[model samples]
Target chain A: MIHNLPPGLIMILGALLLPLLGQRLSAWGALVLSSLSLFAFWTTPDFHTVTLNLFGQDLSIVRIDRWSWIFGLVFHLAAITASIYALHVKDTKQHVAGMIYAGSAIAACCAGDLITLFVCWELTAVSSVFLIWANGTETAYRSGMRYLIIQVTSGVLLLSGAIIHFQQTGSLVFENFLGLEPGQRGAISDLGFGPLLILIAFGIKGAFPLLHNWLQDSYPNGTATGTVFLSAFTTKLAIYSLARGFAGLEELIWIGCAMTLFPIVFAVIENDLRRVLAYSLNNQLGFMVVGIGIGTELALNGTAAHAFCHIIYKSLLFMSMGAVLVRVGTTKATELGGLHKSMPFTTVFCMIGGGAIAGFPLLSGFVSKSMIISAAGHEQMFAVWIVLLIASAGVMEHSGIKIPFFAFFAHDSGKRVKEAPWNMLTAMAIASFCCIAIGVYYQPLYDMLPFETHYEPYTAAHVIMQLQLLLFAALAFVFLMKANLYPAEIRSTNLDTDWVYRRLLPRLFAYIGKLVRLVDSLFRVACLAMIKRFLNWLSKSCSAQGWLGSTWSTSSMAFWAAVLLGVFLILYYL
Target chain B: MKTKDDNSKGGNSSSDASWLERNVNVVIAGLVIACIGSLIAQLWWAPLFAEKHVEASHVEASHDDGTHDETSHDEHAHGESSHDGASHLHPAEFAVEEVFGFEAMFGFAAFVAVVFLGTGLRLVIMRDEDYYDS
Candidate 1:
């Protein structure tokens, strides 16, 4: 029965126990439970499935395949690493929420049916919001609400899409929607509304193009360690879902291109280093989306490989920035500088992460990202290939140079802080090691791909070309800096898509509320004036000495009664 | 007397500041040197290595095809080349492989474009930190 149990159940159940256990015990419990789930994933045979008949439909709760395996394994790894990093946190609520969020993402990855996917998906949205709220600031509270609304909206879309798809096809089985044969691509217009809705749902989570505002809006506001966990799971899960359900959809190519391109601009102007990382995270997802859109064996492999590598390096970068936030109490670029003199290990780890993200040679990104670009070239999509090439350099600008440069090597801010704690250092070291290992010895990663990977990453030409791109980008940074053409880091907020929701929508609602209040008061005053006039008339006519109030009232009343009775009798007779 | 003391203090602090500046300059110079070295290595050494590998893979692929008939050999070679072109693991043949410093030039151009693009965007959307505080 334990073997047959869903892989994520252990973590969810473990989360429930976190409150009962002491803080130290709960942290240990998270690591153990996460490792146990990882062990379960590995031990579970390929194509191993557990089906439950619920509501007259067979729901696949545990569908173990190569695709799900990679995502589930990475989720478990992220959970363990994040738990380790958060060991210093005393807040039990964060611990519980983090474990549950990781569990839900894992459950979603393994979910074989749309209904199951939707349930786990919503659980992830619900549980992850607690991580944001754990900051216990007003801004964090507001951002958490916004994050929750967007996430839950994604879940609602997924549910609606699932229902529509089920009604149309009479099946809830989650699989690729396009029904394209291998090597075939599908156009966006060819998609039904149901799948398109689901794609949009994934798009929101994946931080796709314009729908990506929630990420930059909320991620920087999360607790230091919570952001680390947040960075690893949610968007990557969306990418996994997209690769699973909508691979080879050509529209994703342009969407992916826009996703990669637009964030670079925002990241360049972003003051918060963590927010910069969030934009960088969006840019990285673009590469994966482009791969998924390409929908070839190599491209799909690239998507999977990139996701695996991105989770490691991105987590490492977040952990480094998180360490900075924890030590210095701010990740604002204006406030940080020359941290390497103090937090040397973190800087090194961050540099390694930056190098990997920039796709420098002998780093994980160089190995994984080339697959997609190579796929584009082979397909002769010249425009997309060129855009990707440009985006590659753009990634180097923010994540590669700007992040490490401003945070660690720029003007010293005179704040000397101690290095990060052992637990955090260990987590970062593990992630950094993975980044280097995947870059240098990528054969294992390639072999683990869902499809057979024929591409090699360590080619002389590929390595040189990538080095040329990265180094020349670095050279541009030098030139710009010498010329003072690079934008100066300033403490300011830049308007992004979230501005519509965070500012404009609230103002609009307040204005409407004022109008409603004005109308209500006017209506009340008019009614009150009418009532006053009626009262005045009544007092004047009916008071003593007015009209029939005098001595003649008696005679008038009797005569009126007699006449009324006579009329009534006549009408009754008639 | 007070002014003299203040001047001495200022001089001492300035000296300390200069020391820090010197150390920072040294670090920057070292990094710049390393970057330039990498550029040189990429230009000089990488192409040679690439040529060797490309030739080796080409020979191996051709040998595999030689066992087949002429018609199938051509087809297999075409498939192999296409496969290599698409595969991430393999170094795909580029149309301008012989073009020296193409990646470097392209990278520089991309960086300039991205920076200009970012600056232009900032002009339109930049706001005070308190823009959202209200």
Candidate 2:
């Protein structure tokens, strides 16, 4: 019974004990425990669920719903794959942090109230930083710190909103909160603020514009296995949270539109395969966020299904890059080529993942991605739909084709290397298969929708349109390449939004520091000059020839002291 | 057509053959079939799976608007209306139903199985351990 044994308690117990086991066993053991817990939750009868009260609030610590189940299932599966992938890793800190990070996401999904969500939310922030730190490079360390600061700030906002909402409404139910009531300014001033706070919290995790710098900054810098874990949980969790909290909020449509557009152009020119995928991840989240914004039963279903499929496909893409990096010692498209000769298996998996991401006619992405695109159309948001269609073409260019085309099949770099490790390949294979399975037979995904919609994804028109998009995009790539108009892969940095923090902000701080130092020095000189001037006056005044000469200095001192004391007495009395 | 150096550079190509040799049509076909097959199966399974979920909730409560407009109008015209209150759920009695339950779990299991089996097959065929790095 989950009620009798709350999963959070089990998780806390596991988090505490797992680290005590030796390094090798700790990660694997924690993963096994999480999987077992998932099984326990799954087998436990829905009618016989548990409730627990913590901190003067009764909450459903083991609630079962389509939303929670979707997140929980992926979290557990991701944990298993991550643990297996990290088996060769010797970093105990990363391993422990990963387990804690994943456990928190699962715990959050199971949380019934805002209070519970806040606790798990903060926990996820604290644990995930180690993944970035696991890179053990200066860039990674700095990026990890930035990630922690943003994530914690997001949590703080959510917590503040939650506390305010509770004080105003006298309840802490996390779901279906329609912001602050009007005309009341006690705690929660507006409904918009509550969703805003939660949206910002999710935006950082979801990698929304402005708040998304951390993903591009930190993901590529993490260890391969850590990146795999990074890909699976945090952003997707935020999308789930947004879907739960901010569905049908119209502003999200524009926000989603912006998110969908910005990443593709960046991905088109990006050098690092992982960074490209990071941008693609942002693009994918845009689709889900748009779905949340649309808030139709079909759209929400699309969001959930997209999250599910996105996790697998993105991870597959990352794993392929990881595999390439394993052999070639780099993931830069410019530096990598002819990998297909030695790593044919990884290439095959990558192409599958690429196809899925590009929304190829019969891949997982097609099934879920179409739902959001259609929702936009259904809502008569013709502009958003058109942009999304353009972005879909960009997805294929940057991810579906470019990633593999450059890394594995471009001008051969003449580097001969072996395939990825068995474990690594195994994980990639699993993820790639899911990417395709979701597309080919989308009915299972459609039926799992929380709301019923009669639209079919496989209608001839939909498939034809999608195929045309992919074909035309491929043709465009060929046309550009033939014309030498396509951007050539270069061995240099391509700036992302993170450039704000990475370059501009730090430079701004340094410039401010320099200006402050100059002002400080100038003030010191001016103070010295003022002291000299005062001394010159004092010398004349205190000398025998001066008005207040040494002959009369004692009387002058006494007079001044008496006047100052009198003034002080008056001021003190007043 | 160009410089001697350019001709030498062009002739000394070692990377081109490996990529062309590696495409090996058979590998591409296998990947296509596996990916397409699983996607179709999952698509077919989603809706039937979701329908099973809707059946579980015991009640689909809908309160009918039983009072006709003429009757309400007559009562209102006679000034016979007495009660005036907004319908609200009791906080203690409010319950939220799980709209879609095992549907996600079923989908997840199917996803995991399909991925593992497909990748496992690919690994068997590829044979080389470091298939991705090269």
Best by TM-score: 1
Model 1 accuracy (lDDT, Cα): 0.84
lDDT of 2 by residue, A1-574 (tens): 4545644455556767776778777767766766776776667554344567777688766665777777777777777777776766667787778888887888787677787788888988888898888788777887789889988998998888887777777777777554412111111233555555766677777888877878887788878888988898889889888877777676677788889877776676667889889988998889888778767665777788888888888888888898887677778776776688789899899999999988887788887787777666545465777667766766877787789899887666666689888878887777776777778777676665555444456643345445545654554555455567566765456555666675679789999999999999999999999999999999988888888664655787899899999999999999
TM-score of 2: 0.76
Off by over 4 Å in 2: A3-12, A19-21, A47-49, A179-192, A537-574, B1-16, B19-134
Segments in model 1 whose C-alpha atoms lie over 4 Å from true places: A513-574, B1-98
What is candidate 1's CAPRI-style docking category based on DockQ? acceptable
Residue B100 Cα positional deviation in candidate 1, in Å, after optimal superposition: 2.0
lDDT of 2 at B47: 41
Q: In order, what are the TM-scores of chain A for the candidates?
A: 0.91, 0.89
Candidate 2 chain A minimal-lDDT segment of 10 residues: A180-189
lDDT string, candidate 1, A17-85, tens digits: 888888767777788888887887778888888999987889998898999988888889889999999
TM-score result, candidate 1: 0.86
Cα deviation at A489, candidate 2, in Å, is: 1.7
* Native A-B interface contacts kept, per candidate: 0.44, 0.01
